[model samples]
Target: MATSELIYSVSELNREAKRLLASHFMTVRVEGEVSNFSAPSSGHWYFTLKDAQAQVRCAMFRGQQQRLGFRPGNGDRVIASAQVSLYEPRGDYQLVVEHLEQAGDGALRQAFEKLKTKLLNEGLFDESRKQPIPLIPRKIGVITSPSGAAIHDILTVLKRRFPVVPILIYPVAVQGESAKFEIQAALETANRRKDADVIILARGGGSLEDLWAFNEEIVARAIAGSHIPVISGIGHEVDFTIADFVADLRAPTPSAAAEHAVPNQAEWLGGFRFMENQLIEKLRRQLSQHRQRLNWLEKALQIQHPGERLQRNAQRLDELEQRLNKAMQLTLKQNQHRLTLGSQKLKQFQPIDKIAQHQQQLQYLQQRLQRAMDLKLVTLKRQQAGISQTLQAVSPLSTLERGYAIVQQHDTSKIVKAAADVALDTLIDTRLAKGRIVSQVKEIIRD
Candidate 1:
């Protein structure tokens, strides 16, 4: 079914095969015996790798051989880390090697890497997934060989740190193939018993094979699944295992793990003493505050007491009464002084004395008026006598005696000084000194 132009030549076929093999396969580890091993002066290694029934050509170039932990020779069992490919020039199937290690450790190293990558992918090695160790555990459980040095170190460290805390030991084999099962059962038993606040999975330093039991997947999973926090102190500081990676805390050694599990007694006692002093200080302040509040309340109650209020008001009333009496006395004294001044002014301008003086003056005026009247009467009498004597000298009565008569109108009693004074039809009186006569005129005559 192939096209003529699609056919591959010998060299082309080999090149095509190499490309296909390299693309289809990843880097792989092959464990077998080395045969026909040769190291050229060019620093290239060429060998044939075989098992009991199969063989394959292999090449470890100088670049890869630099990191080799051991020399590969004929009949030596080893592991080759290489790419599966065809040698293009020779048109042969071969392994292009990158590394070589002794098989004993090489297999375990491969298994360790495999399991490490698996648990890492599943997040068992994540810091966020790990639980925090308690500040002070009530009880500590240890899973290790009871007769081993690791248990002794753990117990000694724990006793020195905090001897009062109890310890529960689950004895197990930490080295053999059955060690993984024993450790896992101890973890489960500790959890079921619910007696430990924390558990320690510990072992002393050993070769990888000796430590293989701790690297089992069952033990790693047991640590990952524990409800209580676990501390793994497997091997020395330089040695690490799967249990260390999955545990909540990984200590360098068993003694260090024990140290991490508990707090010192003296330090805790010092902290408690400090707290007790603080509590006493707080109580004293509260008591002082309450006493001050009570005193304030007592004073307030006294201020509002009815008897106190009445007494204060009575004192105020007495003060006001005294002020009123003083004001009235001052007003009365001022009025008395004004009345006394008014009485003195009245005495200085009294009308009774004035009336008496006026009466005396009136009496004197009356006396003078009476004397004047008497003198006036006397003067008037003298004037009357003189007037009488003078009137007698000029009296017409003598002329009447000489026979002279005064003619007058008889009705009027008026003397007629001339004839013109008499009316013609009137009676006339002829007045002599002795008597008067009335005469009637018969005719008018102006003579």
Candidate 2:
């Protein structure tokens, strides 16, 4: 008996089995229901594919999972394309999934995708269509179940931030089949009331099937058609629905929606205080400027007296007259000295021979003196005439003499310059050329 000494390691046996399965079933398609499907944190998916007879373990890497349009979950029927391979370490046979597609419910997913794409193409998710949430909403309308935590959170936030703001709650179903119509009706009611500044549509987190009401087309359309800005806070941070896309604003959580709807009271109070201070400061500055202007006006009025101005002018005129008189006296004295000197020189030049000549010169000088005096008198008289004419032009007495009587109110110092100033049946003082008369005005006439 020549038995061949044959030995093989476990790894070699498993490797040979894997190579045979990969070559034989390189691309085999199997239809089964997904069970325990889980995409681990390592970016690798582990699940079991089961049929009526048996079950098989499966692994789909991240690279292959990326190709899948939708995530597969438990109870999902899928057609998986994979290769039969053996794990070399454990020597266990498993299917390495390369591709997967929903088997029975693929049509529904396709319809959802189609509708989403159509709405997206129609610009339903456009940022420009979004409305800005009011920073300080005066009134907030809540559309949710009356007993839900969402309403509690919103009310608490609103009361804490701004207690004065009024909140109007329109309780509506947030789950189940009838929730959609209730939500739509609530939105319409809020719009009809026109009381709410902004509307908040909120609910707590739930499963996709539980939250199907928010994804309904009618609810989405209602949110889109609402005149008031709608904030969709339907589910958890990871959950999204049609309402989220159609709403004017989407909040990740119910608490976040409450925070977004109103401002903090402390912050608003701080800002208001700052503005009040600024207004007060501006008023103070204006008042100070007006006070300084009043002071300047008072000083100017004190220096603008007509009597004081006249007194200063009189003093200046007197000084000028005194200087003029002194100049005239000095000129007269010089002329007299020159005359005496000339007489003395004539007498010395001819003792008694020049007596006739000296007399003729004296006569000529006297005639010149007389002519100068006449010219000065004539100049003085002309000056006096000009002064008289100027005085007459401005004199009230001169005006009265020209048939225009000056009338003064008997009780007031003001003169009745116009007929309109004195009414009929009033006492008045009339000044004529000779004297003044107190009389009552009977009938005043104006031309």
Candidate 3:
């Protein structure tokens, strides 16, 4: 191997290849001729699915052969639904067949798709509508053929996972023309009785025709309508059915369905033990804290005596009393000293003497103010005389007195300044300095 390169053992390599192939080609429906077919004592059927150009090994377990219509020999053409896988021991690639059909069974495949589309459009296969499967069911109801390997596998797996839960078998035919009716009735009956918390609808793998009962609308509707959540364990891992879509949960096989229905007992027990130990440890820690507190309280009570506390309180009261008395004496002394200083200062003020001095100053100021007022009055009177003379010089009355007459319209009192101010025969008013006269114009004049 190259340095630092990851390497795998033969078994690991084969397992990894098988997982890759299984995940890559989840379900394949292929047509090929059967060759080298063999059925062993172990109830398993082995064969080679081949075409002219290629071949692949195939296995159909006995559990899947109940409804296989005919045994396919070499040279027989067939169709199968299978998953690609590698057998680790032999390191050989092979196909694990889920269902086998004769050359012309493509019609069933088409019908399944058509029904799937119809239900999907109707919201019957909606994820929101699916009920939650109970992790720990009180009781589980199974709808399948009582004698089939599917029922046995489910019971065995349930015993291994969780055996406390009761299993109620609702015997019904898992194949044939009446299988759909039986399944529908079983589902309705399980719901009506309310005996089981969850329902498991299961059957073994077979030809497409044999498993068609699960693909029927009646069975699908019954599963969808059931009050109890339904878990469909139909055929092999590669098988797809209408019931699978309608059910709350779908498992590849009956054993897997049982595994999904409950949790592992060993794991749960281990978890419970761990939790119990943790709880005990926490309780111990709390008890230790409480014990420490109790011990501290006991020692504190011993160290602190009630009599000692009383003595300390008495001393504090005496100290406070002495301090209060000293504060009162100091306050009184301060007040007395302040009173003496205030009295001496009040005597020094001498309000009467100060008032007399202020009166004298006020009298002198009054005389000065009176003199100033007299001068201001004289100045104002002079100014008034000058303004009167100025007004007389430019006054209209003085101009009129100088022999100039003012003329105006008699009725309107409008002044006439020019010859055009009067119209012919219009009445006029003429005013001298002393009086006014009214006259009429006899002639028209223009200047």
Top candidate, metric TM-score = 2
Q: Which scores better on TM-score, 2 or 3?
A: 2
Q: For every model shown, what is its TM-score relative to the native structure?
A: 0.55, 0.56, 0.47
CA-lDDT, candidates in order: 0.85, 0.83, 0.85
Assess candidate 2 and give its TM-score to the true structure: 0.56
Q: Kindly report which residue stretches of model 3 are placed more than 4 angstroms away from their true locations once superposed.
A: 1-103, 307-447
Please report how far candidate 1 places residue 352 from its true position, in Å: 10
Candidate structures ordered by TM-score, highest first:
2, 1, 3
lDDT of 1 by residue, 1-447 (tens): 668659778999899899999999999999999999998899999999999899999998898877765687888789888999998888999999998877876668778988999999999999998999998888999999999999999999888878998999999999887899999999999888897999999989999999999889999999998999999998999999999999999999988988888887778889899999999999999999999999999999888764455556556656755675576567657756865675577578976756666557656865775576557556655655565555455556656877888888878888788878887778998888897787887776676
lDDT of 2 by residue, 1-447 (tens): 344665668878889999999888868898998998887689999999999999998999999987788888899889999989888998888999999998754644554566677778888878898888888788989898899988898888878877888889998889888899999999998898897989989999887666778877788788888989998888899988888998999999877887778888899899999999999999999999999999999888666644444455556656755675676667668868976897788667855777787778878876886677667657755655565566566666677788888889998957887889988888999899889999999998996
What is candidate 3's lDDT per residue for 106-148, written digit by digit as tens? 5577678889999999999999999999978999998989999
User: What would the TM-score be for candidate 3 when compared with the true structure?
Assistant: 0.47
- Angstrom error at residue 56, model 3: 29
Q: Give the clash total for candidate 1.
A: 0
User: By lDDT, is 2 or 3 better?
Assistant: 3
Q: Give the Å error, residue 263, model 3.
A: 1.8
